[model samples]
Target chain A: DARVTQTPRHKVTEMGQEVTMRCQPILGHNTVFWYRQTMMQGLELLAYFRNRAPLDDSGMPKDRFSAEMPDATLATLKIQPSEPRDSAVYFCASGPGALDNQPQHFGDGTRLSIL
Target chain B: DQQVKQNSPSLSVQEGRISILNCDYTNSMFDYFLWYKKYPAEGPTFLISISSIKDKNEDGRFTVFLNKSAKHLSLHIVPSQPGDSAVYFCAAIPGTASKLTFGTGTRLQVTL
Candidate 1:
């Protein structure tokens, strides 16, 4: 089955270090989304892209968080000078079209730990 | 404010019994709703979805019912099995393929 794939399933870093996560969405899917999951906050949409164009990133903290889809096969979410509060599982999801009702397929996710 | 809410933290049901999970949404603009199941260390998998235009959608053992007036939805699983145990999430999409706002998950435990 075609599934979204994410790199570095697990990562541990210092509080001020940089953390980068990568994802490959399912082929032929047009919409890509980045989300964070923590025990307290269920799931927050950090950013979303359509046809490699970023649609909305208001959910992301402008200073430390950045998301990009350099190409259709790859999407990256990077956090610089990460804080302990940044520890969470980051997920990448993709959908078939620009329709709200289309079901999204998600990646296993990258679990990040900032100490 | 939480747009989607799954108030129950967990639910326990006996095996072979029917399990009904509920979800409520505050956003009237949300036109699409979906239910997802997630295992530990795994991504949330699509279970079922119902559009605003339809009141209900079903696939095999899983059925999702949507009530537009109340902005509520429920997932019904018949003959629940141990394998069905997992965390379930309710998500709402406000616009066409827009960002999904998810609710805190509800863990379903199917005891044998």
Candidate 2:
């Protein structure tokens, strides 16, 4: 019954405000991923961390978006000066290992709205 | 530049019929494919998966078929039920790549 836990199931903020989303991956999982889902773009991987170290963040906008895993249990995605276009459902997923055959388990997601 | 694509955005099928969802990938380096089912407001749940070496994998009423030569894969659900109606996503993992490249997803509706 282990699952990835995400905080703040929904968020609404004005444009230019900072928004932070948090995730707690399943215990003993080593890989964590952050993704954004939009009607136009579908689901896009924004960033991921393996063993508490970032493996990729190329899909994220470096100027305003940041993803971090302070420890194995905590992963966070923050958007500074968030804009309306940033509105989307942010999902956090975790797997047992990096590049393993195991499927990533996802959290319910945080629905963010930037006005 | 979508490496993975689910051409059909939606599908409707009668209950007790077979539901087939197709996905095509452009990346030959992809060695593993997976199918996930997502309900509204819920996370995508892993349904089934297939490796490059295998052509088919099954779990209960769900089966996944992979065609490496055609770079295509499909998910088949037998005796589709009302509860089976959801968005299904196809995802791929390239050789040694840690992340999954997901398709746009297909919304399936089972009608009685």
Candidate 3:
């Protein structure tokens, strides 16, 4: 089965440090999404890319968070000057198209802890 | 503003019984809805979905019912099993947008 792969399954960092999480979506998927999961917020969509072009990122903190799909296979989410509140399990999902009916497949999230 | 809401934070059901999970949405534009199941330390997996045009969709043991007028949906698992225990999230796609708006998940525990 083709699965989305996430790197550094766990990461612990101090406040003000930079944290980068990487994901490789399933092959042939054209849409990529980033999400953050926290106790209070559950799962929130941070950003998404369709055909390598960003379609929406209204959920992300513009000043500290950034998401990019450098290539079709790889997608990255970065937090500069990370804060304690930034600690959460970040997930990456991908789908075959940018259609509402297509279900996005997810990767085992990158759990980040900022102290 | 939370467009999607799952009022029940958790539910417990005995094995071989019926398990019903409910979800509601405040957005009138939401045209597609999905239910995802997640185990500890694992990403959520798609369980089932229903479109606004249809009232229900079923896949084997899982069935999703959508009430467009009420903006509510429910997931029913018949003959619930121990393996069905997990955190289930309700999500929706507004209008023609591809992004999903999710509800705070409801943890379902199936007791044997």
Q: Which stretches of candidate 3 lie over 4 Å from their true place?
A: none
Native interface contact recovery, all models: 0.83, 0.67, 0.79
Give the alpha-carbon lDDT of every model: 0.93, 0.94, 0.93
Against the true structure, candidate 1 reaches a TM-score of 0.97
lDDT tens digits by residue: candidate 1, A14-76: 999999999999999999999999877799999999999999999999999999999999999
CAPRI category for model 3: high
Model 2 iRMS? 1.1
Q: Single out the weakest 10-residue window by summed lDDT for candidate 2 chain B.
A: B93-102
* Residue range with the least summed lDDT across 10 consecutive positions in model 3 chain B: B93-102
TM-score of chain A of each: 0.98, 0.97, 0.97
Off by over 4 Å in 1: none
Docking class of 2: medium
Model 2, C-alpha of A14: deviation from truth (Å): 0.5
Model 1 agreement with the true structure over B68-97: per-residue lDDT tens digits? 999889999998999999999999987644
Task: Order the numbered candidates by TM-score, best leading.
Answer: 3, 2, 1
Error of 2 at A5 (Å): 0.6
